[model samples]
Target: MSTVDNPWELTRAIAPRRYVNRMIAEADGVIRSNSYPSKYPVNGNPPTTPWAMDLTSLDGRFWFAAFDLDAKTPEAFEQASEDLGVLVRILRDTGLPHVVCRSSPTGGFHVWVPLAGIDKAVMVQLADAARAVLPTLDHGMLCNDRTGAVRPPGAPHARGGASTVMGGADDVDVLRTPTVTAGDLLRVTAAFRELRPTVDPADSSPTGPVDARHRAHRSLPAWGEAHMATVAGGRDPSRTGYLCLLAAAVSGWTLADVEHAAKTAPGMEHYRTRNRPTGGRERRTAAEAAARLERQWAKAQERAVLYRYAPEERAQRDLTELTGIVDVVDAMLLAFTASPGRWTRTEADLHDSTVLTYLAWLSLRTGSRDVAAALRSVAIATGIPSSTVDRSLRRLHEAGWISRRRQADGPNAAIWRLSGRFSTPGEHVGPLHDVTARPPAELFDVRAALLEVLEDRITAGRHDVFTRAGLGPTARRTYESLTTTENAVHTVAERAGLPRGRTRAALASLRRYALVVVSAAGWRRRRLDYRTQAAKKLGGKVHGALQRRELQYRDERDLWAWWQDHLIRKGGRRGRDRVPTTQAVLFRAEDERGGPEAYPLYPCSSDGRADHQAAMRFVRGGLLQDLRDLELAA
Candidate 1:
């Protein structure tokens, strides 16, 4: 074949230096390859063997925004070909340059649009816009940043035939010519936006007059109004406003309706003001505020498309009964606690168990196995930090104890569902002996009784003890287990669902405070008042340990604050230079002695040190209670 006609040359035009290859054989059914990219001479002839080109470069830039369409039979292939024609017409109408190729002998199609060094996220969005029109497009091809390789034109397919350009060498020139720029992609996205169906209030109810529509928007739910009025530290105002607008949009409110509600709502005064350049707030003109509301209203409409509720659905939601399944969930927790090997082997494992148990309880209390909760909400409910709760959720999902059904979006918490192991009746096999099969009683307030049971098992209701004693979940759980009965270290570890070493260490710590005692049989708790005994035991040698630690933490925080001020004063240092220096100062106290190890840092480099100091402050605040509790006990 000539240079323009050569399949390898055509492939090299789009991905010249980075391509993978595989041996062509019928037995090689899988798409496995250990091949790495290597440079090839641009002027050289095509390689003798078939090769595939990576869609994304090593530096995370996309060479082409591509789509694949496959069919299992000839009839399906014909149908797919018709859909391909429709897609081609759409692209042609939008003036997007593209290339089409027969990807395999079994009749899969690959459509490629050359991109000018576009990022993966933007490329995915462009593809999504196209997929909205053609739903049959295979999403896996560009589902993530690390998209797999595609067999280039002229490359041999393992199944039989070689990939061929659809219009032959005539259309191959587009791959090497001027490509689709970001501006072009944006224009196409805008065109696709026009194709999206307009929101219809008729789906909610009969089309109403302008005043009737305003009345509908004014009927905000209690939760929606609360979200709009909430103003708290660490909260994003933009996010709060967007969620409030989304709540209205999903309820079938128009843009005018949303703006009117924002202006008239009692607690929505913040929406009328804009920050000045001098760092002072000023009330915006009506036109300026309306423009801002319009932008937010558009975003809310796009996001709430999937969640929009009909009139009946919204009206009946409040009337639905909240039947509690505390009995069933309690049984599930009992079973999970008894089987330590299934969920627990380490301190982190115990945390995952605790989070999973709490999620089950929340799900049952809501009268469904599906629960919607934010990380902060879960943290508040379980007394675990938000960061730890996030990790526990990941672990629970990975271990098949729970699964996230939907991600959190505007005004909506993430929806999580208990797995079959907990949700399915008669599936929990443990010492509970089929307690989950029993009929649940209707309890008016299950929270108090449920909390007592959880505290007895996992110390879930002991935030005060956690703060006062500086005890983490694992240590608290071990202590709770010991309080029930005297038991060997191994037995206590089993009951607490912790590692033997951690259980032993907890025992030693408690013994140091005279809260526990060792005997020939096992370990037992002392009957004396724990706070008084602990105070008297630690009064002398360890009396000032907490104060010293607090001082040290405060000094470290001050050092970080000074560094930040120094950077601000200097004013010319880049972020790269500031982060390492700030981090060094923040962690300067760490050495051979025990210090905060594995301290969680914020992902943003600029705020990482500040966030670390905030965590330290929280720790020091917790220690204040320790001192006060000890003094009172003494």
Candidate 2:
């Protein structure tokens, strides 16, 4: 039985590593002391098909982890066994996958693959294919869900969990890894949930043995082919506030449930480290001291924000002092700013480089779908290894970061959408619009109509055509009487069917369906000021850049150099501080011909995915190398 203090030790123990066998051997030296009789049922051979999935601890407070499995561990290594059952059911014809675990904190899980005679890779392929209809799942507050599901970079509980497949009953199977039980997940969840936001990072010294009870139960008497091993890789990580987050997902509790419990838990009410009850000043002297402390603290945070703040900030205090927390926050901010995505490096993040790299890989991979040389190009750009990339992707799928589905052909690329929930586009952790894109099918009708209107406008009867569209009737009459003698009565009345009070709604729908333009023209039709969404993000980046004077190589004089460095190639200069026009493409396709042969490809907007893929396919097939000299000269 795991408790609130060490809710994830089991996870850390079981997480996959480059040398998993070695790590398990080392952990066994000490795990024997905590061992107990198993309470969970075991389906070692997986009478039914099996699949495994469970959460991993990233920041412990801000993120979650997940992975999939096909076989159970030998024995005594049941970790996240129960959660695996839930994940497995989505991939096979099983209603619930069996779970196996020892205690529960940080131990890896083993799932018995179905006896379907499917190859290991094929089983994984099938499991990936049948994963939940959506590409994300909820593993408590920590979500190792789909990539590019934008969230506030620094916000907590931003990920949407793992990808959860939903289709046939028991499509996913859950076999035990080291012979543990499923209910243990619930038990551990309950225990950890007791403490939350109260566990201040400043006071959390989560680096020791937690003597919790071992609660295990197993029942698979009907199956004869069960094998178990006394392996030692389980538990996840610390779960103070992290535990409270799980309660919401496990019990379907409201955000209110999580927020209240976590925010007011013991050991963290004020969440102060060395300073306590400084809530209100007791005496005049204390009050003055408090004021000075506030000023100093504010200044310290500023210093921490600087890119190289680790030395000064880390030396200032221990974990118990709020200084430690200030330092951690500073680190998180820096990590977030450097790379805006699913995971950022920080002092508080879990010390699992593999997991972090895997998360980054997903973010890059998902967003670069249209880029032909995506994987290889990004490897060069970021200096990451291919094996690390491959492993991370495998683990992420197991954990539910994204889903894998069979392509229409032999090998299929899994399609991932960031946690498929209605989160405000980018309103995740810090500040970014993370809205889910609306499927194009739903907006087809509206878009089709709008396109017709645009095509008709080419005839040139009257330029100001809003009034005739029932958008600006009064304004329409004014324009018509002033511009041309021809009357647009038919056009005006036909569109006038739009409800009187719903002019704005109609226009909004049109815009959503890609049917209307929202320039000065749309404003005139709706009789509303077309306020542009605040460009806070762009402004913030610019402000930060200027303050740091980081643009050292900016081309202040040469226009061509400036255009290439930035993704722009057209338009006059906007100003020194602003980019003129972000025309991303510079040269036409095949422009290397060096003459009019490629001139027809002018107005260099890329052919997007198609052209790039053609180029890459040629490269992949060794065609590029064969014609390298000729192509280069052309």
Candidate 3:
């Protein structure tokens, strides 16, 4: 077969040195060999070792930008097949034909359009065009850097999987090597360049009016061509007719136009012959066959008007309004930090403040009380694990801070809305106005917020009780639950969302680490009450603070550290000195607008550490206690 006729064969002819099969060491000295690209072509001799992850680019070779659809597991592989169909549809709709290879049944695919040493500018433009169409593809494998490495198709994966060609094979019974002549590849990419702007760059949220009609016009031909291929490949006459008719209706094509397009669609005639060939004697002319197709198109037009081609309008909020939303969230978080009880019953329940901040930002950014985002998007933005986002979302939901609405129509995204309790009356969605009402202190995920605080302290050595204890998640949770008051083992277990056995095991581990004191001398003999022996033993006012709930200090030393970090201001004759008194510092900070007071509260205790109890009491009974009191004082 001509190299131009086979994608794999063409690739090999152009860059024969790119392919290599090399030994890879697995567990127990087990060795495997698979095809991987060398750093550069070696004139048919490959390197002895596999390519390293850091070796991202190569030189002196004709390269293509690759979309690597890879699944790490079998389930994902199956899902990838569906994703592949979406990608093919994207290509069809955009009217760009490119070669695609199923690198393995385990769900690995490489879709590529060769760059003919195209200048950097053209490549960049092509990359952007590719990105524009990428959203239509589910989980499309693309890299930010267009010049990155692409694995050759001839070799198996190092993990021991075979590669097979996909798309436009004549026989379903046998796998054929994929091929696209160099000239064809370039022609398709050039066509992509022309169609790139018909639809705006893949910005789902456009700030201004988009040329919807123009985009729709450009998309029609690709849609028809793609459906034509689908019909040919499926060899279903009815579907071919249905799709062709629907395309005509949607595109507003004349019956004559649709007939002409379908007849010349490369494989249309072949499919027509195989599915419904006209016999001899009464030999039907091409005109008669075209009429039959036109009839089908006319039938499909009846239902096509119902399909929507226009983009929906999205609500846009001014940048200042967006900033105001963030400020409100900050204020809410600051208030929560002052008193964890304002949100949760226990301080330890505040797991990661950063995640909470991310959630708040997302909600505000979307200009809605509710946010609908994929967990993957959250994880990427927050730089945390998707699992962590899942856990945090669950905690927030349980705490009554936000409610989740699972997507019913498409994609795996979930909708999250801030609690009505936290929202101001008649407040418009988005960040247009500040929520003036006193922020709610009675509900939220306190632990999620505190995790961010703990992370800071951990880095500063201001607190290490939890980390030093080396407790598992269950143990850590159990220990936190035991901090404020002793509870029955079952109660603690239920609160921590663990099984009885698991909770018991966690409590025992905490006990072993001296983090929790578990007592078994209760009425039922198996009944247990727990307390944080570690915090109570810290001595001085810190110990008293923990017992009386007068302060939210985690450690005795943390109080002084918190004071040094926040309360002390630097404006003395010497240019840097303590502000003298906590009351005075607070007054100065508040008086100077946009000072530390304007920032999120990082309150210190009387002796100088985090004291959520005192902070809450101070805010309630001290500063800004009531408008009536202010009037009386005035």
Candidate 4:
């Protein structure tokens, strides 16, 4: 095979007859108008901008299969490069002809294999077979019909480079490459399956005696079984069914085992008849239904490789479980707070502690430590921004308080578990105090009330009301101590499991907002609408502070933009070095000026360029407009 002289011709030849689309990219590699059915130029010659094409033709036949290997970091890029070699070897072994290209300026790659017009179902099975062998393959690409368009070869990558042919095959004619037939794909799939040893469910004894760990590995965990059972009544039956297959795969079950279990499991009855057409007059035959199950099982096995449980993790899973919310709350309080008083030493410490407490409560309420919650949900519950919540979760993970099982994707939330570090509470920390006077059974209800109160306060112009109203960790505990009745400072301290000094300060802060009132009888929560009153009291000061912050942000943004322009003019230096140079200049000036407000654009130690990018996004997201609206309301 000889690479074509014009890559655009290759791209045109590969794209579907209809539904070719165009996409534009920003300087920073962010794509705009990325959705499907976008406008594509009529004349070929490959538009100056990036473009995408549907994988399937108008007739619903797949013309090619592509794998996108995205690498976000240098280490990942190196690994992806290695994996690319493995993928090429696999294809060569299967006697399949393919094309390879550098997908971006970064070390990401894309490999496209031409296929004769094949049914989508057969294409999917071929993709799954490849996925089982190559875990790094992007499963989202060819998994469904509505997967949207993919940037074709010869297109401009969003990340500031052209997608160019790789592997010294520039002379290869991509358009004339030989295509794999459906029969060839099926043969390759069978060869791939042969690589894995098959397990039989009917035989109690294997060739060798199975140990306890091996036996455990071959059966679904309690949680997996529960998730699988959800298929019976879940709104999204397909998702639950996939989860079941994933569970089976993670438990080390083979395709045969999964098929057998699906045939027998009560919750999986629907899987037995999945071969029925949407409105067909007759049901599919038993053999056809079994074949359908085999295909799904193969796909799930591929995806499950990423989530397989490690030996240590399997042992630690039991230790992560909690008996009830009380146990979770007590464990978190003990692990996060300082001894004797359960008090946090600094604001940052307090924030982490509060976030952990909230996550623990959520886990217990869900009857599992594996809590799948979005950052937004946690932010709303804790009265913090989503970014801050993310940071707090990372901190908790670093501190051995939690372990993230899976990162959130699309509509799915991240799954986190209270780790084995705090499995056993140190000792009875004293009678667990119920400051909200809420019954332990009403965990979610109390969370709803807290969210409502927080929303009202924020909407009325009081941001971070929890901290502003002296509801810091210590203060919140103190205030809760007085929920049932008034108490003296020392008594409140004891009830709140805090130092007397901390209790007194909390009471003073609460009293300032009239959230709690003090008299000769001690301090008690005010009977009035505290949320409304607090918002009213803090609105002016909060808005003024926000306005000042916005002004500073605008100044920094303008300065950064100016610096970029200046650097571009001076030496035309661009890409990675420019950002570090700009940040260095800003830092030097900040040192010379010597003040808290002097270098507002200075990079944070934890995240250098990311901090600057966030500031830019903050301005772009219309925070300034929101501030103007607030000012007008005032």
Candidate 5:
């Protein structure tokens, strides 16, 4: 005596399995499904004997609006029957056909309204109309989204409860109402649709007077785009549920609005949550779900408002006030190359150097030695990828050249303050790489002199040797590190903010290109000790240009006699002559033209002997490697 002639449907009604003859325990709880399985168990394993029917998903698209009643004891069954009598009277008034069946032996009834050959939406509308008439019914079940759970007649339930038909049809018609046609139900459904609350899915933004500029044209926020994508993905309805709830909370939408939007969304009906159990309890009602969603939404909003908006964006200082700072910074950077010592070529990578240059410029512009730099914003400014910039900045921090202070719960960029020992001056001074200690004040003086000379060289149009070297970003930065001092690989990488492997690779590339030479200093604990020196050919083009300029000055007697004499000076055991130093040869004309006081290219170092030795090695050892390439004989 089944509605359809499918034995599988009757078997499904008897089984405890949820979907496709398999019981499923999701976040919502245990569900018995009657949907067809894509593949059945094989290799001697049989499918579940009986599966619970998913009434809403059965063929013919007829919707099942079930009303579950609990009586507990035999005596309580009387009240349940009385309640069903009241419900039947209400349904009879609407002329809708229905059934009354027993769910468990202990006494509970499932009064189901099966809409014949109608769309599920229409069925839900019919259920809503029925629910409206019997508003006081405790266990009212509305199958709006086709997600509710319904056990088949004669199925097994918890607590030794066996389901059976109580009354309906000719076989069982105790308290049944007059059966109505499917067309009559459809007509009633069409009428219910008019009464349903409607909300635009796209119009969930917060309610407020739109700004004049935004009034003419409106667009969703970034978060809204993310929310819609999450909903459409349908991977997890729980996440979507929270998102929708939060959206509603922020936009001041009611539960009805959320439901309407969800109902209208294509494919959203497949997300069944209503009949699922949470925490071993039945799924929440529409109002309960809304309230829970609202609480979470409120907490999130509070956290964001308190922590996110408290701090300002970037702190902008007036440019006018930073005039002196800019000029001083510009002078230092420009003169850095001209001043002697191991300071000219920092050997910093292009990205790192570029980042530093920007930081320097910002310090000048912002009138603060400490600058706030965002990796993304910095990448955009420097034309480097954000990932690369991030690596470079990490390297910079490790090198102790810069100090970083991270912002706490703010949109402000990480705060970066130039190293006082290098930028300003204090106890920590002298050569950044020197093992020997020197007075902080004295070291600062030496560094200042070098920077001033570098500035002069820039003004005089000296070529930047780093650019002419044609090295990769990391190699160039590593090369600069090598030029500074002989340090272990880890030390160099740490100083450069590069990975150890990257630093090693960069060294190999530099050696391959003959930019620098690495010599084994000694072996310590079986590890080969290494020391690197810039190849004399490293500054090949600049060396050639300087040589040519020097020759022109020497040939022109119009140049000052002392200058000519100085250029022609000799020093050896037997008074043998040697070429002038690189700086002397390069800067003589500029110095002569613009006086030593104004163009201080070579400031006297406190330790002249040491400076002289460094200069001699720089020209004769480092700079002399490419004498042939410089075309000195030509």
Candidate 6:
């Protein structure tokens, strides 16, 4: 019987696809692979077993594509981009009855679960469980470049660059050792484990033509030339998942032959190809994205400046993030800050229990400041070996946030100091001992700052809306009481219990006509600090250049108009005691003898000179602004 409707359909259908006998044929470049599960048929049996697994990525863009061995579309990859919230919500609420794994993508996350581990009935159950759980997602805010921070688009995607986003078949850095060992195999296995994130092994390789289907898809020279950031923490390239080996290759087959296995297997060619890259409108849209990044960077920097209290002369009165910083640099800061607190270290576990205990004990001993000091004293007094403290301190010091300040007189013990700014994220710090070092977030410090910003915004009613935008309840009340009950800046400052010194200063900042002002004595307080028409934001470099270009163009226009007007009003060389205003306007004789003649208007010359030809065009153009070519071209 044909297997379609049979309970044994999946088993019979999936059997000859790749497996031979009771064993599965190894691909050309596969180093390690756990058993993949599915449902299938055996002989004429009513039921059979097959295998399957599904995965998701965490780099922000969401997907929940699945692979079913029984179907014609085994490695078919389909995405639910805007429905990220819906899919993740489904997985979170209605747990699947299968073994699962998770991976991180550039934007969001992914979930990996094997289908064979759970029976088809349970899989159906899982789907039913999620029927009520998936929420409708509104992704209007999650469009191109709307993330409100600078993200590198990666060098404008040069001609013939990789078109599709692909991951490695495995994330293994290959070895050049003379001798192979069990240690090497384990390391190799761990490396490829990361690459399974890709739908195709090509995902782990370069963009151009693939010589072999299942071969290790790595191009080292290409990587070097492109200057890509492959892995976090500067992992050694060889140890990276840029390459993989085919551990299960059939004996006696050439490497070329083995690679052909994956060529037709799960992931073949799936990337969509358009007629061309983009449109003219797309170019304009790209610019808009670039503009938004500039704005967000500026805003984040403006915040930094406000936090730093930069003076008005240095401060731009815009919605920018910081004051007196380059646009891109400020962008980086905002992008980093938007992540909020650093990535915290995983919870203490057996692998690091000793280290955590040692640190905990050390925290107590090293401090003369209250608890820390008391703990340190107890550790030292109780005869906990000083060597243990030394080792713990060494790792902590290496983490950068902590430093060892040794005394010259020398009890010879290390005095570790935490030199981190609260703003200095912990994700950057906690990675010291991590095989893959990454910082741990210091939640306390970050949460404190967030609270301060939220409280005031809530109370003021200034924005008129706050909750959806993230203002705290206390902030709302403070805004209300300050405006309604205490109207004057000083009075409001008093009622708000602001520091005396800061209150006056902050009031001064708010009171400037361009800044803010409060009206009413006590009934209702309204804010008056809004942007003036002249308050435009531009980056430091481009700001000056664009402004200069505008000013120069304006001056030239005025000069041309003024010369015309002067001839009209005074006529040529009238017999009067005129100050020669037109001549003075054209030129001042400090540097040159003759007015106007010293810098005569560039005359149109259709002669052989290139400069003259350009001048002729400009003259005929009537000093047009060329709104078409202006950087702010409409």
lDDT, candidates in the order shown: 0.54, 0.25, 0.41, 0.52, 0.42, 0.26
- Find the number of clashing residue pairs for candidate 3: 19
Candidate 3: lDDT of 211? Answer: 27
lDDT of 6 at 267: 20
Answer with 1 or 6, whichever has the higher lDDT. Answer: 1
Cα lDDT of candidate 2 equals 0.25
Q: Model 5 TM-score?
A: 0.23
**Candidate order by decreasing lDDT:** 1, 4, 5, 3, 6, 2
Model 5 lDDT vs. the true structure? 0.42
Q: Model 4: runs farther than 4 Å from truth?
A: 1-5, 25-37, 41-45, 168-174, 194-634
**Model 2's TM-score against the true structure:** 0.19
Candidate 6: segments with Cα more than 4 A from true spot: 1-112, 115-225, 228-284, 292-634
Model 6 poorest 10 in a row by lDDT: 272-281
Q: Per-residue CA lDDT of candidate 4, range 189-263, in tens?
A: 555443211111111111112222212224686545654454331322333455567668767888777767675
Q: CA RMSD for every model?
A: 28.1, 31.2, 24.4, 30.5, 31.2, 27.0
- Minimum summed lDDT over a 10-residue window in model 1 is located at 204-213
lDDT of 1 at 219: 63
Give lDDT tens digits, candidate 5, residues 331-392.
54542333312232343354555666656645643346666776555544443445766887
Residue runs of model 5 more than 4 Å from their true location after superposition: 1-51, 58-60, 70-79, 90-97, 133-141, 168-182, 186-634
lDDT at residue 281 of model 5 (Cα atoms): 16
Candidate 1, pairs of clashing residues: none
TM-score of each: 0.33, 0.19, 0.32, 0.33, 0.23, 0.18
lDDT of 3 at 203: 24
